[model samples]
Target: MSDTTQPPFSVLFVDDEEISRNHFARAIRADYRVHVAQGADEAIDVLARHGAEIAVLVTDFRMPGRDGDDLLRQVAHEYPQIVRILVTAYADKDMLLQTVNTGDVFRILEKPLRADKVREALQLAIARYAERETRQQRLLAMSETLGFLAHELNTPLAAISLFARSVENDVAADYDPERQKDIGAAARAMLNNAQFCLTLLSSFWATVHKSGGQQSVAEAGGREVRATRLIASLLDTYPFAGAQRDWIEVDVQGDFVVRTMPNCVALVLSSLLSNALRALADVDAPSLRLEVVDGSEPEIRMRDNGGGIAPEIRARLLQDPVTTHAGNGGHGMGMIFCNRIMQSFGGRLGIESTPGEGTTVTMSFPGPRNRL
Candidate 1:
C-alpha cells in the first residue's frame, strides 16, 4: 500500500453506555477509523473478526458484561500488538495501579472523557503501533534472507556430493596405490566441503524458523556430549583425507563432559577443524591436536602446526564473510558461525596465533554443574 493512500489507523472503543461510546467515537472519527462495542462480549466479537485491521483499543472500565480492565487484560494477552487505553470513570487508584502492572493499560484517562485527551491517546497509540510493525517487518526480512541463502547453496552442494562419491568409488578402483590415495584424498575433500555446506544450511534454517515469541533458536539441548564422543562422531560422519587425518589428534581428560546441544557443539567443532585443516594445506609438517582439560571449567584446545594466520587477516577472518579464494580453499563463514554458537551457549571461543608458527583455537564451556 502506498503510504499516502493508506487508511487511517483503526481504533475500537468499548463502553457499557451507548452515550459514552458514541461520544468517544465522534471525538476521534476524523483522525481514526473507529468502531464501538456496547460490552466486553461485543468488543471480543469485533476483535475476533477484525483484529488484524484494528491498531488501537479504547475501553471503559465500568461495563456490565465485561469491565474495561477485564477487556484490556484479554487484549494484552491475545492481541498485544494492539495498543490498549482504558477510558473509564471508575479510576480506583489501586485498580489503575494493578492494571498498569499487569501490562493492560498503555494510558488511563479519567471518565469525564475530554475530546483532547481521547485524541492524544489515539495519537500515541498509532505511533507505538507503527514502531512495533516496523521492527516485526525487519525481523521477517532477515529471516527470509537467511532462508534464501540456504536454498541457493543446496543445489550445487548436492551435485558435488553425488559426483564425489562416484569418483571415490570408480577412480579408486582403477588406480595404483599411490595415485589411488591421491584421488581418494581429493574426492574426500570435496565431499567434506559439501557436507559442511549442507549442515550449515540446516542450522541456519532451524534458527530462522523457531516459534512462540522466541526470537531465535539456541544451541540444541537435552543431551550430554563428551569431547571424545563428538570427535569420533565427526570423523565417522565427514570424509577427511589421510593427510588431513594424520595432521590432527584429539585427547580428552578422563570423564570430561559438557552440557550443551550436541548438534550445535558438533557443528562448531567441525567448522573449527575444517578451518584448521584448510590452513595446513601448504605446511612443511602439518599437525593439529585437540586436548581437553577438566578443571573449574571444561576447556578444549585445538592447536595446529600449519603456517599461522597473518596478523592483518587474523582479525578479519574471525568476523563474518571470510574470503581467501586466492589461497587453498578458505571461507571464514564457518568460524563466524561457530563464534555465534559459542556465545549462544554461554561459552567463549578464543584464538591465538603467531606468524610462521601455528594457530590454536580454544572453546571453553561450563563444566559439570556450571563450574567457573
Candidate 2:
C-alpha cells in the first residue's frame, strides 16, 4: 500500500500544530504533492485558491474555530470530489462517533501516525476517488454512445413512420369492409412495429440527451409517487395489462407513495412489467402480484404465478441476456434496462424462480427519509 505508484495528486494536510503538520507533510514528501494548512480558515483559503488540484484533504480531528469534523463537513459540502480523512491526536469517543456518523470522513488515522500508515491511507483515498471518477467517466461515455445511436435511428424512423401513416390513410379512404380490413391489419401491424422501434430510439435518445445535458444533474428533493397510480395510468395503454391484470384484481390503488423521479421509475417498471407479461404469455392462470410493504425501505415485489423460467435460464436471467421468447425478438434488453435503472436509483433487482412453479421479481429502495 505505497503511494509511489500512483500518479501525482495534490493533498491538503490541515492541523493547528505547525510541528505535526510539517511532520506529516515530510512523510509524504517523497510521493504526493502536499499543501499544509494551519487551520480551517487557511484550509478554506487554500481550497478556494486551488480546489481543482486538491485530490485529498487530510485534516486533524481537533482544531481551533472549526474542528476536524467541521472542516470535513465543509469539504463534503464544497468539494465532494476531494476525499476527506480525519487524522487527529484527540481521538476521543465523541470525535470518533461524529466522524463516522457524518459519513464524510474516508478514514480516521490516530495520533503518532507513521509514514507507512499515512501513505497507505492516502493510497486508499486516492484509489476510492479514482474509482468514483471512473464511474462518472463511464457514465458520460455511455451518454455519448446513446446520443450517437439516437442520431442513427432518426434517419430510418423518419421514413418508416411517415410512410406508415400514409398507407393507413389510403386504406381508410378507398377500401371496402373486407378489403379495408386486410389492408388495415397489415398497416396496423407495420405501424406497431415502427412505433416500437421509435419508442426504443426515443428512449435511448432521451436517456443520452438527458445525460449529456445539465438537467440530469442529481437533484435534492422529494415527491409523492404512488406505485398503484403508475400502474393504473398504464393499464389502459400498457400492452400486457389486459392479459396479466385480468386474473388478479389490482386493489392497491394508493397504498404506498415514494419520493423519486417518476420518469426513471417508470422506465424501470415498464421494462420489468413488460418482461413479466412476455414470460407468462402461454402459461396457465397467469397472475401478477404487486405489493408495497412498509419497512426500512419501500420494498415492491412484482411476481407472476406463471410457469417459472427453466433452471438453466433462471441462473442467467438477469445476469446475462438469453433468447427465451422468439416471437417478440427478445434480446433481454428489457431486463438489462430494468436492472440498470434499479441500480442507478440506489436500489436492487432480485429474482426468484422455480423451474415448474413461478417467477418473482423484487425491487427495493430507501424509504422516504422516515419509515412509512
Candidate 3:
C-alpha cells in the first residue's frame, strides 16, 4: 500500500487490564494503526482476522485464560513472520529468554512500561516485520522470474532436442561409415546441447518449486537416487563440461548406489562442473575427471587438472563468495549454495587444490558403514 494511504504499519496491543490496554492503544494509535484486545481469546480472533495487516503484537504477560507466552507461541508457530513483544512484570530473566528463544518474542518490557520504551520496542518490531515482508516479496518475485525463464526456454529446447535426435537417428540408419563419422560428431554435439539444457531445466524447476513454497513434491530429502544414472545424466547434460566433453573422463569402478535427490545431485554437480570448466579454460591439455569411488566411501569426485587456487583463496574457497570472475555477472554464491545443499542431504562436500596443479571437489553422501 502507498505510504499516505497505508495506516502506519498496524500494531495489536493486548492486555487483560482495561486501563493498561486502553493506555497502550491510545499512546500508539497516534503513530500506528493500533488494535486492542482484552484477553488471549480476543487476541486470537483479532490475529485471525487482521494478521496480515498487523505488523507487530504487544501483549501483556499476565492475561486471564492464557498468558502472553502462549499467544506468542501460537503466533510463532502459525504466523512466524509477525513481530511479537511481551510486556511483563515477572522478574524471571530465564523465562524471558526462553520465551524469546522458543516463542519468537522480539522484545520484553516491564509492567511499569513507559511510553517511550514501548515505542522503541514497537519501532524495532515494526522494522523486523517490514524486513521479513521485503524478503518474502523478493523471494516471490525471484521465484516468478525463475518460473518464467524455465517455462519459456524449456519449450523451444524440447522441440529442438526432439528434432535433433530424430535427425541423428535417421542419419545413423541411412548414412555410410565414411560420411557418418562427421555427421555422427555433429549429431552428438546437438544431443549433448539438448541434454545440457534439460539438466539445467531440472535445477530451474527445483529452484522455482522450492521458492514457491511447494518443496514437498519429490521430497529429495530421502535417499533413493539411481547413482550411475544420476552421474551419467549430469555428465551428459552439463553445458560447461559438455563444451569440452572430450576433456572430461568418467571412471566408475563399480555400480555405486546412493540415496540422494537426483535434482540435488544435478545442481550440486553442475556448480562443481562449472568451476572445473572455468579453471581448465586456459590450461594446456586440461582434464576434468569424474571418479565414483566404491571403497570406504561412495564419493563422486570431480578432479580438474587446471590451475589451482592460491592459499589465501583456498582457505575460504567454499565458505565465502570468493570468485575469480568478479567483473562478470557471477555473484559467486555457487559453491556456498552447493555446500549448503550437500549438508542438507547429509553429505560431505570437500575440496582440495594446489596452485598450478589442479582442484578436486568430492561429494560423498551418507551410506552404509561399508560404503555402497
Candidate 4:
C-alpha cells in the first residue's frame, strides 16, 4: 500500500492517455503529492492553481493538441522554478535529446514507463528543486546582513567626519604656515575617507530599500542623465589622496545619456576606482583614464595602467565572487555586483586586459531611445 502522509513537495503529471496518467500517478502518489492532467491545456490550468506547491512537472511528448515540448517551453518561462521532465517513447528519443540540450527538459522517461524509473526521476527532480530554494534563501540572508551592517556604521562614520573637519579648521587658524599645511593635509585625508565611507553606506541603503531585497536594479527607479556629467560628479566627490587625483584623466568623445539609478552607478564607479588605485599602488607613473563614447550603443570605459589581471583570474572575476586580494579583506563581490547592475539595465560590462600592459573596463548601455 502507498504511504498516505503528504510529502514536502508536489508533482504534476500530464499525458493524453488516461491510463498512462493514472498509472504514473499511482506509481509515485504514495511517496509524492501528485496531480494528474489529461493534456497540455489542463496541465497549464493545474499550474495556474498550484504552481507554488508543484516542484516537478512530468509530461508526455505526444499529446493531441499541444505537445509536451510546447508545454515545457511555456512552463520554463512562467514557472521557471519547477523542474521539468519529459516522458516519450523510444522513437522520439532523438528529438527529446534536442529539447534536453536546450535546457527545457531535466530528465526523460521512456514510454511503457517502469515504476522504479519513475520514482528515481522524481527523487532527483525534488532534490534539484530543494537545492535551488536553499541557495536563494542563502543569498537573501546575506543581502540582509550586509544592509544591517551598513546601517549600523553610518552614525559613527558621520561623527568622525564632523571631527575631522573641525580639526582642519583649527589647524588653519593656529598653526605656523609650514605646520598648518602638514596638519591640514592629515585632517583632510581623514575627512575624505570618512565622507567616502558615508557615500558607500548611503548608496547601499538606497539599493536595499529600492530593491526591497528582491527586485533587480532595473526595477529600481531612475532618471536619464548624461554619462560624462555623472562621471565628473563622481570624480569630484571621490576621496583621492595626494597625487592620486592628478593621475586620472577624463576624455569625452561625445556625451551619451542613459537611464539608471544614480546611487547604484556611484557605488559601482567608487568600487572600480578603489580597485584601480590598489592595483597601481606599486606601479610606476600609473594612469587611469575615463572615456565616454557616443554612438548608437553608448559606452563608458575606464582604462588603468596598473598591473593587469592574468587570464584565469579575469575569466572568473565577472562569473563568481572570487577575489585575488583575499588576504587584504577583498570579498570579491565588487565586480559581480557591478555586472548584475549593468545586466538589470539591459546593458553589459566587459573587461580587456593584457598582463604588464593595462586593463580597460567598458560599460555598454542601451541607446537613448532604449534607455530604461
- Candidate number that wins on TM-score, 3 or 4: 4
Q: Which candidate is the best by lDDT?
A: 4
lDDT of 4 by residue, 131-172 (tens): 777556435434533643353344336546665766767666
**Residue-level error in angstroms, candidate 4, position 111:** 38
lDDT of 1 by residue, 1-372 (tens): 455764668899988778887888778776777888898889999999989989998887777866877888888899989999877566366667777778557888887898987778788889989777755643543443454345335443764666577666767486677766666666765766576676656654544454222332222333456777767876666547556787777777754665544455666776677668767888878888888777776777899987787777777765756644335333445555566656654677888888889999988886556521
Q: Which pairs, if any, clash in model 4?
A: none
TM-score for each predicted model, relative to the true structure = 0.50, 0.52, 0.49, 0.51
Model 3 per-residue lDDT tens digits across residues 1-372: 356875658898889888997888778877888889998889889989998888988888877888888889898888788888888886756667777878877888898889999888988888888678655644543443344344334443664666577666767686677656666666665665576666677766765565343232234344445567777877655655344888888888765665434465666677677678778889889898988886566788999999888888777867886876454334556666676656654567888888989988898777776211
Give me candidate 2's TM-score against the actual structure: 0.52
Please give the RMSD of candidate 3 to the true structure.
14.1
The superposed Cα distance between candidate 4 and the true structure at residue 69, in angstroms, equals 27
Tell how far residue 279 is off in model 4, in angstroms.
1.3
Q: Which stretches of candidate 3 lie over 4 Å from their true place?
A: 1-6, 90-94, 173-372
Q: Which candidate model has the greater lDDT, 3 or 4?
A: 4
- Candidate 3 has a TM-score of 0.49
Q: What is the lDDT of residue 328 in candidate 3?
A: 36
Q: Kindly report which residue pairs in candidate 2 clash with one another.
A: none
On the 0 to 100 scale, the lDDT of residue 243 in model 3 is: 48
